[model samples]
Target chain A: MTASTAGPFDTERTRSVRGASWTAFRAMLLRDFTILDKRLPQFVAGTVMQPLMLVFVLTNLFPRIGQAVGGGGGASRFSSLLMAGIVAQTIIFIGIFSVGTEMVRELGVTGEVEDRILAPTPIFVVAAEKIVSGGLQALFGAMVVFPIGAFVPSTPVYLEVRPIVLLTLTPLACVTAAALGLTMGARFSPGTASYLFGVVALPLSFLGAIFYTWPSLDAVPLLQYALLVNPLVYASEGFRAALVAGEPHLSLFVVYPAMIVSAVVFTVLGMRGLRERVLS
Target chain B: MFLVPRLQQTPGWLSRPDISILRPRMHSLPPANISRPGGTVTLASEGESAGNGATPHPGAADVISTTALKKVYPGGMVAVDELSLSVRRGEIFGLLGPNGAGKSTTVGMLTTRVIPTSGSAVVNGIDVVAEPARAKQVIGVVSQANTLDQGLNVWENLYFHGRYFGMSAQASRAATNDLLERFRLADKKTAEVEALSGGMARRLMVARALLHQPAVIFLDEPTVGLDPQSRIALWEVLGELQDEGQTVLVTTHRMEEADEHCDRLAIMDHGRIKAVDTPAGLKARLGGGASVTVRADGEIEKLASQLRRAVFTTEVQVVDGHVRISLPQAEGAMQLVLAAAQAGRFRLTDLAVSCDNLETVFVKLTGKDLRE
Candidate 1:
């Protein structure tokens, strides 16, 4: 049959395993992006809502109500300080929802509803492709949320942008966050997804150092050290190193390696969890 | 040529895969027997090379083959046991069994979803165990659930599947349109998958499975939830597949459906095959060999043992408070029934003569009715 019909993948290069796998991998990515494009409104709504609320309340509404933040850095410097933090928070949240919740629905404990896993590629590529897709969505979330954080304040937000740092640290932050989401998605079944918000997302949102720098938590010494376990803290700190260049955030030296390690760990765990769910 | 599946575990797969994984391994495989238990002229072994790991391939006659295939879940439940099957190209083969008879597990093993606990399955010359991804390139599957991409509309479902199988965008779109038209789903191309009826959704799934022109298509309970009209439509599509020379493996508990559509059938129970033969062959094997079932007022076993010797019956057994007597043929069957009844002291509460059919054959072999 193959001899009679030359498929799109019938060329000499494509007949090779590596070339065929690459072709299928790219096609899977194309499918992800195509769906994302078709549902642009939903993607925008999911990406923009939380950051829009955070920037509005903390920078715009808080000062008008006479609330003080950033230890009297004043509302404007406080805006600048929280800007990178909001970028980090937005990317992380978008990453989780874009990848995690959808996965829970697709690989639900009852049965697999996702047919994408049956793609003619190695099984692991399916999980890897999702992580990559989610990370890309998170990056877009960062772009959408940054302007809201930068310009929404009542006062002129003090700001600086380091192009190289932003470009370099942003991808690491996005993928780490996405990989974390994949781990949670794969670990929990559909029935226990509420615990995702209660146990996982709640801690990630509150203790993620979005409103205050990690150094500011020195007053609560135990809590300060405890938040180190959260991958989001590094994302927040890494963005601070990029957007607010000279702010009091965690060292970039520490942030880079920590995020990389977290991304690697989550990728392994998430892929294993998905495989175990399907292959068993 | 495809790499061994074990190598995919490395991170290098995400980057440039090593050329070493692309090298193909070839072996002169020996043919295998398509056998049945009890050696009753069904499933006779063709070549007696049992454990040589030289199981049959798709090249010679069968387009799909399995040798001693088994799947034991982690919890110690044996789902499929020592299953060997051979399916020729262009034929619709069936696995007919009640629920939990391991029919789905066996299909799962063949399709690359469930890894085998032992044994091997090869599809179109590819060893499913050693290179599942490559094996997937040759096989298509329609799972029991409606696995249409909820994210994509009906057309995009087929289009994306084509793309996933390495079709170019133009090719994917063309094939998608062609399949939608063929399945008579062209009008519903833009509709969301959630909006589709049970039958329309199933036809769309079958369309998607065929878009890439896979060598074998596996459909699990294809007509279970469909209406009669929809079932006819699906069967028409299967008939078209036969014309296209596509090998089909379907599983269903509907005896009549299997009897009418499948070229060969394997009746499975308790994770093992009770029989494998053409529907006509199966019926003929038991043809004219009707059974006389007697529910006696006295001890069933005692009456059963006495009747086994007194009556010129082929076989006799006591089951469910009744003694069943099998006759060699339809002629003189009445005299034997009368004789068996007299030996039981004419205390028959209820007596029945089962006609020869797939269900009867299933009941006679397993001592259990197919419909509970």
Candidate 2:
């Protein structure tokens, strides 16, 4: 409409993708944290309630009523055994609910996923950011185990800290859970995701070695081998090795490699599934 | 796999006098009844060029071009057939069509949302399918649906978008603040995105798209849910964007808006472009004619026969309960029509005349009105 129109574009901004993806990844992760910052209370409540309440009721209440757990040490031994399981399962659940369920919701009718799909980065980078952010949330959820393990059980529950194993297993466990969540988010539609939670959640918690070590399931040998197929079994065994190493648990060899394999496999599956879901 | 060169290969388009000659000749149609009555609608020059005078960025480079693009869903639904289009930088181009005419599909292919089953689309010198990430860097899209991050407040939405474009935190914050001020959204910076009114939300979206200064912006049916006031406000912003040399592509069924705002419009139907030209150029194809329509209380076909011999009637056609008469120009055609009607003993109720416009062009090309 004007003869003296100005080319308003600021093309001087460095046109580059070489440094773009990393910054985008960090910013996307920060976006999740920004939302998480507001929902901190809800997140804390949702994350800690199930694991802590499970620990208190089983270790504190059950002993009071003489319907105790554990082989010999009764309250104390069961409390220590239960601590690692709770930490492991809580980490995995955080990943499932935070990354998996959130993915399902964003990808559903709301189409919130569309907001990030065009981030000037590879779609997989966007997907990987979800896993990392979810892993971070799962890490915070795992911390809830320490305080609950310390104070909630009427009996003294000792969580011996093996610094090396704890630090390594912590990230590995969190990432594996988040990666599995990514896969679930990609797999389930809104209508069936709830049903998936119902069918999958109970089995994962109960058969997951959450209340007992996988070694003890030797009394039920068929069940012990079958539990190997569950990803959470490796996380629990790894945590038990980290927190209750003096007790009977799976070997450090089996725990580390099994968890590593699970992390790698789920990450690959999750990334591919996410790509299929979004690109079509 | 149809690769369209940036400009080297488009000799057919470049050699044409103007964009109007990029034209596909009007689709063939069954002849409508016409009678000259006593004399032809005459005493007027027929070769005058388009008069609305929209100048789409002379000598500007192509910001977007698509050639032989096509998409077929897995279930065998062809959303967009082989379609070719070009948009110039600093021009506001409109894709005008009714629902399911493949406007959105075409936009989707260009925006990197919908994958094409075949053919090529390039945006800002990047092939969209092959280098989508680079293409995405230059193009911003405002989708028809509300895809804002409902979880974040308005300010955070713009802030994070800047960050996603690789801006530093401080820079992102600064850009977000400036955009909020420009769009008159500074007061509502902290408001939840879902809580903003329709106009505010749309403005926020446009701001978010511009935060990184993308080369082109695509708005798919941008005014669909907006009220008249909001619609005008949005167009005002678009006009300003055009003056600043921002290329825009909007898809809509609204004829008047397209005519008023777009530098050029590509009329599309049934998954292909029916015509593409400046609004004035498309309407000019109807000649320097004016059309008059009259509703009557008698056999319509009988009135059509009577009007065929009217002194100034150039063409006559019956449509949707009214008889329409076309004239070289509307001067004195109304009285002649009325006089001819009276002599034939047909009672006329009322009549209206309009200069040939986009709607008439659309109907003439597609055989149906746009509102459908």
Candidate 3:
């Protein structure tokens, strides 16, 4: 009612468009969240399934079969390392694939995305909302994966849980993963989405040092540096440093700064891609 | 495919000029008669002159205007070609064209959906290409296809549309309630859009477009595929909008729709404007007058030539063994044609007389049926 105090349908009602852009942005987020709320079961299933399977097979089944993951009592240490890796992987996969696939459908001939684009905000704002929404979904995936990682393994995996590092670094990792997702989603079409999961996502997760620590990957020095090109590597290392103690992991200096830089780079590229797609 | 018989005659209401002033050449016809031919019915001049009683606000000029606006898709397909026109503040303008005629493309350019490849378009005084976001603030577009979010209910669809235009939640809710009632979707407020009937879904789409109370509304094929009753109901809603001084640009291929509802219309074909005028003005300019169809056998060319010489007949053409005669009055022409048939010793199988309408004008200008 306050927005309409001047009169209904009056063009001069909003003297400033900055406030209008913020309102539109919030509305876009609200719409996505409302749809997510209605489809909670699907969201939960999608977010939970991958991490559960990874933690169960590598951390639970392999250990029960007496396959030494790392060495004696290395199973527990490996389990703790895999916990962080699975969580990071869940966030990255969900963030990228969910948004990318959905964007493809929305931007197709159906033009369902037209409603969002029509908002009195820049096209980049719409793209940012998708990233933010994906980030939140990634964070939710992390939360769901943590419990499964904690209980699914036969070995009792101990975590340091540094409050400062855990709180700050986990969000950074989730955001970096979300930014990577945004970049991929913006660049790929729906028909190529399946290829993205099979070709791009699988390589990123496996090469991200999810199963082994970055320090351990120093054994294969060339592989360690090559894997850094994958944004998921920084996220996986950041999570390991935050959740596990006395483990061979990347330094806090490298993890934090790399995550931030990757987030910024991916966000800029994603926004550029979004503008091109929208205007074209 | 079911066409109402042309023999039913043109309704008197169809030609009752909506505006007070009628052009000198647009003389009112008798209840069932047609306009006298040979007078030049020029296309109404652009801008305010083309409007009925519609007036722009003092500070605001044309509601929508385009100058040489064109759209060229990738691979060299030109969807809209050098379109230039001006629509005043409160007139109901119709873009009449068949499928693939660039009506939708023109609407897309004006609505800021499809970026124009060349030229310029201004909506609500804001250049569409330069300030699309600002232009979007004052216009609402209902696309040809259903773009409603099927996951959301009817009320939610309207509410979100309003919110996108910067309306507060309370204002959006209020507007949603008002629109639902006006669109007769109040009872279906909580129903999923996909669950509604085709007509209800269309009404919801229109209601959603109007929730923000835009200055200019573009509706692309708003009543396509709807039943007759639903189409009429939608027309009444549009008529009411016109009465309340809302500027509307609607695209449809139905000649009767343009004839009955539009104050003025532009006929488009192959990405070009074939003609533009008031429905009756177009009918008068191109329709010639009334027409009589004579189904007869034996020397059709002779019958046609003989009929063309009659005092009332303007032209005659033989089409598929039937004589189609254009004349000022069908009543007198019918007798003359019948007497000619008897003199020629040709047996007349059937005869029908009808006044000129938009379909006739469309066929005359485009050399094809409106639906084609």
Candidate 4:
């Protein structure tokens, strides 16, 4: 039998790795957004309700009922602080909660995630698609929270909004939060995911320096330094520096670098966790 | 080629040479050669001469080849053990085994869903363990469970799957429509997967897998829960795919399905293959005769022993409330057994004679029913 020079198999159907990865990424992102679009009412309600309630009760109802947060001129000052903080908190919670819960469902015994994993792309790209889609939702969550925080409170709120800073810092904050969500989502089981709100989300909000400025916690220096571990703290401080000026807060140099570092760290960890979980 | 040693002693009915024992070492064959008659190429290893005897041609390039592929889960549970097999291009190959037989694990390893603990698996010439993403490009997998996106319609599922393989929007849409029609799901294109019936969902899963036109398609129990009509329909589809030169590797517990659909099959049990051959070849290994089943009220063990000693009987076993005997010729053996029974005063309540097939071979080899 003479050896044949023809190729072992046809290559027409095979795809370039780079092209396939890009296509798979776009398809995954589109799938998530399509689902979100179908569930828009639920999305809006879930994203808007918590932040609105927080602003209404803490900023508006508290002072109206003669229970001012701080002291003289303190209610209005606290309102502005609450406004920026609520936006930051809303973004973080939406990122972590949304991605983590969805991941729990996807990684279950009978999961549709199997289809996604079969795509002709590296597993890390699948993880990244989840994070990017989650981040986009977080950005939307921030937008929804902003208007509610601006008008719902009874106090006349004063804000100094910087367009460039807001645009730059908001995306960074959302990405970091979403990356953290990806990591937690891969790490936790569905049964354990519910505990995330109580154990992680609630504590993050309180210790995130949302109720007061990071520098203003000078009276409690240890708590201030410890709260630095929370990514939400950087988000709150970044928004405070942008929307409320002359307030004691972390400088832009610290906030921006910290947010960038956190985003990178969480993203790396999340991808690794996702790969392990999927391949195991 | 490797030759399995023959049994030292044989009954009169089982005097045929065991040709099925010789397994071809296709992995050691020379690279792709010119297609010979029968679309096969004969390549000899160092220890064997090419023209010494008739060897089945290694037809087409191997689509999937695994050597000593092993997977050990945490806590040291071995899912697949030293599994070495080769699936040729453009053939319907069946992996036959009962539940918990590691068929799923082998599929998982080859499909890149579960990582192997040691050794290697190559799918469509790409090493699955080393480059799973690339391997995935050439293979489509339809898992046993329903994996269709519940949130999306049938068309969207196919479209997204095509896009994942890097197809353009126009191409994806065209492929989706074509596959929907081919799978008889065009009417359900806009219907959510959650609303589809069990058979429709299964068909949709297959349509989704074929969207990218993969070289090899793995179907894990494709008809596990389908009705008889659905199973027949799926069988026709699989036959068409094979005719179109699509290499299909399927895992199924149904002996009838394997016999009807697979070009060749490997019977796997306890993470190991007991035998591999065509359905007819494997059946021939079990004495190549007819089976006589006698259900009597007397001592079944004594009757089986007596039948085993008969000149025409090759083997006898009592199972499921009947004494099954294998004989070279059913006509003569049945008369002789009936005369002997009448002479011995052994009353027979029922008797049946049928040709030996894959199920008989499976029972003879594994000593258990296929369903068990």
Please list the Cα RMSD from the true structure of every candidate, rounded to 1 decimal place: 9.2, 10.1, 9.5, 9.8
| CA lDDT of every candidate | 0.75, 0.78, 0.74, 0.78
The residue-level lDDT of candidate 2 at B237 comes to 86
Model 1: CA > 4 A from native:
A1-14, A109-113, B1-60, B287-354, B369-372
Model 3 chain A worst lDDT window (10 residues): A1-10
lDDT of 3 by residue, B151-243 (tens): 578889888887777777777787788778878999999998778887888888888777766777899998988898889888898887776
Candidate 2, superposed: residue stretches over 4 Å from native = A1-14, A71-73, B1-55, B286-289, B293-324, B328-351, B367-372
DockQ of each: 0.32, 0.31, 0.28, 0.35
lDDT digits (tens) for residues A75-121 of candidate 1 = 77778878988999888887677788878888884243346677777
User: How big is the positional error of residue B212 in model 4, measured in Å on the Cα after superposition?
Assistant: 0.5
| Model 1, residue A34: C-alpha shift (Å) | 1.8
After aligning candidate 2 to the native by TM-score, how far in Å is the CA of B74 from where it should be? 1.4
Give TM-score, chain B, model 1.
0.70
Could you list the chain B TM-scores for each candidate?
0.70, 0.73, 0.73, 0.73
Query: Which 10-residue window of candidate 1 chain A scores lowest in summed lDDT?
Result: A1-10
10 residues in a row with least lDDT, candidate 4 chain A: A1-10
Cα displacement (angstroms), candidate 3, residue B184, comes to 2.3
